[model samples]
Target chain A: MVSHKPVIFVVEPFGGSIRWHNPSLPLIYWDDYAVTRGDGIFESILIRDGHAANLERHAQRFCTSAAALGLPEPILNSWINATQAAIEEFGEGEGKCTWTYSRGRASTGIPTAWVSIQPISDVVLAQREEGVRVMLSERGWSFPSELPAKTLNYAATMATLRLARERGFDDVIFTDPDDGHVLEGATSTVVTVKGDKLRTPYDDTILPGTTQAALFAHAESQGYRCKQKVIDVDYLLAADSVWLVSSTRVAARVRRLGEDKLKAPDNENEIRSLIDAAMTRG
Target chain B: MVSHKPVIFVVEPFGGSIRWHNPSLPLIYWDDYAVTRGDGIFESILIRDGHAANLERHAQRFCTSAAALGLPEPILNSWINATQAAIEEFGEGEGKCTWTYSRGRASTGIPTAWVSIQPISDVVLAQREEGVRVMLSERGWSFPSELPAKTLNYAATMATLRLARERGFDDVIFTDPDDGHVLEGATSTVVTVKGDKLRTPYDDTILPGTTQAALFAHAESQGYRCKQKVIDVDYLLAADSVWLVSSTRVAARVRRLGEDKLKAPDNENEIRSLIDAAMTRG
Candidate 1:
């Protein structure tokens, strides 16, 4: 049996209209800043029940990310339309979608923007079910505050993940080199639960996690207190439960931090149910 | 009048063969890690006197960078031949060539590699002649030692340059945020000259600059003392001359660091001549 490719769309200049694009053909030039310098912004969103989850929040963050990079204000209508079209074609129950907005070709100032939708893979499901063993790695330096854009510059992150895999772990969480405080996971925001409190690292040193924020709101409605602060290693290790949360992988419980093993929290099923409800509602 | 485009070539898998590719057409897919995650490495070399300057040194650094990213070891012969072919077609005199090797599409584990040659723009020449007004900006954080690679994660670099331009400067010199010491330029290495001494910061915290290394070698043969050490603001301000050296720009003298104006040193021409000799010989 032949496999079907994911749905992809390319948005025109000034966010005019998005064109259905062939995934097999090339879509960007060599001189585009996206590839040449990784000078652009992107967002990954979760699709569920034929709808994009928390798209508004993702779009807002996408705009903020673009602004940080001095990119033009994105046309939300165009992006929303493209996302909807892609999902409609994908015919999905569960999948992930991503939007890439680049600085365009060197010769032309027009931006290159695209959206792609793909079904969620089995590995992600397995990660959710079995949990992940994680290691702590320092992200030595930080980007200056003046340009606090989470642009497409993830070489260090990827390298750190590779280092973790080599060391026989499922993922890695980055710590601030200066103070040994938790920053984030390679591709997710980290949250720790202690009793009724849900704590995540402060957004000052990392990208604000859309899924985490949504889950926090839902948990708060369920009488769970939520706070964002500087998280140290000891605080993480002492938590009753820890989760690596992102758009696609809604919540993957951390089974281990370093050599210390962690057990599932007493309310693990309840928390998962809350996350599902939050994502589905959004 | 219709304008001509730069020469570009795409390398086949395993560096088998290179085909001249049209710069106007899209050459990379949306899902390629080069664009998605900046999971790649690149090197820029200066083309001079009908040949690529310091081809062997650049290739060596390329391999080192690839290793840092856990990329497949580069085929040196293939890269060299492609560089020669591109130089031959570019047809002599003052140009810049870059090689980009990226982790390929998400579905395929094969790598994507390409070469492109473009003429040096007049703005670069102007910066060299008139000198640049540089502002000091802190890079805030550093990457961990295990992943000490200079991949195509240039978003911060480009943003820093943009911040400088907005503040009425030509470029930026990034300082280590923790201690307020010099790191390097946004795209080049920092070198300061006082009397007959040449000093650049130690390479441990930054990408080892190939141009700075070559220049120091040539300067040493010419009886100029060279040292690599931690450089503070006071030391940088007190230098008789400061230069930002790189592959494409060769050496751009810094006329102003922050608000303090500086005069061109007595042996500026002699130093330029030495640089020319070093590059031509290589």
Candidate 2:
């Protein structure tokens, strides 16, 4: 069940040289206090045909998120080059690479950054093919501003995912407690087609999925209606089609939620074309 | 500004030889990955007259918190003895020691186990004598049950402290968003005297402060009324005296909050005596 061609790459601190733990294994610096403390920021990107998909947007967001956490920005071009070198070293492939930047190690009690790349899991592709079952889980996020940027404090999200798995669901959907607005999935942005409009939660509460943003932009350019708005559970249940979007998964449709089953979209081909377009964007 | 004599100690991880990078500096394995990733637990204990204060309770909570995080308990007695040896090696009077256990490094993802011990800062003694000002900050904690145990994920608490310091305060008091219940300080317990009754926030929303709990038990035996219940900002403002309790500070009165200045407690001698008795487990 390999998702794509196999590839291996090294993760280095933002501006550092690529080294390996062993001559054969890529050296990733996990010695930093940040990785344990979750005191860093990261972005997941897709590499297809040796090009990083949505690299600029991912880098910009990563920088912004890092700034919010008071971390120095990793040299984006160096990271890109390092990632490219790793990808080339592993040979050509359709896979995922995660770029993580922590605060550099100093006496200042911040984190030192590191990055790692691995082959995308086959289960992601399988879910893309078969769609997925999701459960609504309380992540306890009350304010959008509090969670605007990505931080390493992800234990709550992990707990939600664990609970979702225990409950026999493939993924979890989080909501804002103040107004019960459907926020996003644990690791993905939520998008749904209601009648003729594609809608997503409008706020900084969740990570803005690069794939979802690009897909929505492409959808709008192609004369498909798209919008960002507060989505309630009732609105989600009545949506024509539900999709979870991320860098790796692209666009995974929601097959069943709780006891209610959903029908596949009539515009499934168009949605895939939008995903393909997103993947091709630099 | 050094108000107390220094006693220092170092501890090695269970089953590991005491390694030192330099003869004077003990090399302790700290899973920075575990600490930054919030994949570890830690305990701070007061060392007085060459003995760790509340050795049994501190060791127990350290094990309990680690267990809650799915980590196996390290050799508690060995670690304790190692600490004592370090203190003996360094000599002792009044100082603080921290024992931290993290899930060690993982091949990938997160770690499974690691530990370290180090001496506390000297500034803690200064704060004890001069008193400290605290600022009220909102943590927006809506879900209490999910975060019952202490983890390395302390970014929010750190942020609150930074915010407080930026506004000219030494510490911050966090409150619940749902009902405006005063929870506790970012790193200490909140205790205030309202008339003859000593009150603290209930134990559910915050970590059970060892020093604060012991003080309450000792206060009750000394004929001071003690109560643990939900307290709001208004109650805190109206208290006869407000103090923050922790391992290092033991107990320090809050002199001012925002624009409101509080008078030093009339029962200062009695309160200090109670705190001393509690520290001695009388």
Candidate 3:
């Protein structure tokens, strides 16, 4: 199922529009602005067969995050249309689509919306097959209100990721400094499978990932026990299997955590089955 | 000096260069792009007599902040030339000039630079004479490294300021959550006169205000003792005089804090004298 590499398409809703400026400059510039300033909120959705997977859930999350940040309501229909346009422009591809909105520019110091589109890199697809080795890092210093929203202030996460990458790790798992409880990954949500029971962190400190939520629902329907509870790093290391879920990478198994190599089932078919279930729902 | 309202001018480095497909729309509509995402850093300078006050310091701080966030450096000479061009385009005035840079329209995630100029608002100038009321709030959730860089993640400050304004205050004094020590103001540095000594918070949790540093130097030369220490909210309220210092406002007394009305001195001339001395050094 993961034979071919997925190519994700990124789109910026306010990018190509000429309502304000000449749409001559590619939306890539606007995307760069979003990335640099962390000034906006973004939602990433998996795309399969030219349709966004769990798009409504992603859109609702986007709106909720935007509202929390006091940003104006994004025109969801227009955004959907923009996403469709981007998909059509890029053609059918297996990957994710991201949409971002910022407060518009005004002297009042409010942000306006901006958007962009990009293709997923090959390395992201490679992680699905080879799995990932992650290290627990104490970073993600954020307020409660800010945790759930995908705001652009990802400097801390970026710093941690850079450190993790330099230390020969694919990703970093953030833990609460107060008690050493696992929070989430820098760009993805964490799910640990102990036998049939799956547990995730229950807090606003991490994004409520669309893919994770869908997987939870599917797991429940399949009579698999799922719980959202605060789990310490010890529990995570002790878990039988740990998976990181995001819009782009559905569920990548954690093979090695720190120095401890955990026993993961060689059930690639089961993992692919879970992803297929999500794709069907998509 | 406070008898008449001051005039302001707004300039953009990309003013003529900004290509707009829709001329009827406001320039702000174009801002909906990445610049608003706070993916950039900015510096605000007070321009007096056709010259930017503390131009070097402002430029250096701007560069430092940008570098901290991994943004590409703005060409200093080009920036100076562009700023001069902007000022020349806007002519001379007693208002403030703000230079904002976003990672420009480059494909790189790092910000290039975007510059905009605007006149200082009358309300900001009004506070110079009328003084400002402040309320204390918590800014404990942020990390120390993030505190040093003036990235666009100002949501916390903005929220505090909004609450302060709603409560009939000019701005907020952020306090440490652990011990309730006063950190700094939302837009300015907090300084208090206790006996003949001037004191402010000493920590990387606040932007090292250039104006505050200058004030310390001027105060020392004027035979006033200068100290940097952890100050509690209670101590701030009990100080002999408390002032909010920034480049544009120079110095403004805190007339009220929470429920307590301060007996602050209306020695605007003396404060201006010190500010003028510091500006001369710039």
Best by DockQ: 1
Residue B111, candidate 1: C-alpha displacement in angstroms: 0.9
Best of the two (1, 3) by DockQ:
1
lDDT of 1 at B65: 91
Tell me the whole-model lDDT of each prediction, alpha carbons only: 0.86, 0.67, 0.67
Task: List model 3 lDDT by residue over A1-282, tens digit each.
Answer: 333322222233334341222333333232232433444677767776777888878888998887776666776767777677666655656755666666533333444444333455667888887789998887536664533576766545655676788889999888877788888887888988877788998865567777788888888888788889999878988887788888777778888888878677765558657756865585
How many backbone clashes does every candidate have?
A: 3, 19, 25
TM-score of each: 0.96, 0.82, 0.83
Give per-residue CA lDDT, model 1, range B120-149, as digits (tens): 888898987888999998777565566666
lDDT of 1: 0.86
The candidate maximizing TM-score is 1
Interface RMSD of each: 1.5, 6.1, 6.0
Candidate 1's error at B67, in angstroms? 0.7
What does the lDDT come to for candidate 2? 0.67
Q: Give RMSD to native, each candidate.
A: 2.0, 4.9, 5.5
Regions of candidate 1 where Cα sits further than 4 Å from its true position? A1-4, B1-4, B13-15
Sorted into a CAPRI-style docking class, model 1 comes out as medium
All candidates: DockQ? 0.76, 0.25, 0.26
What's the ranking of the predictions by lDDT, best on top?
1, 2, 3
The TM-score between candidate 2 and the true structure equals: 0.82
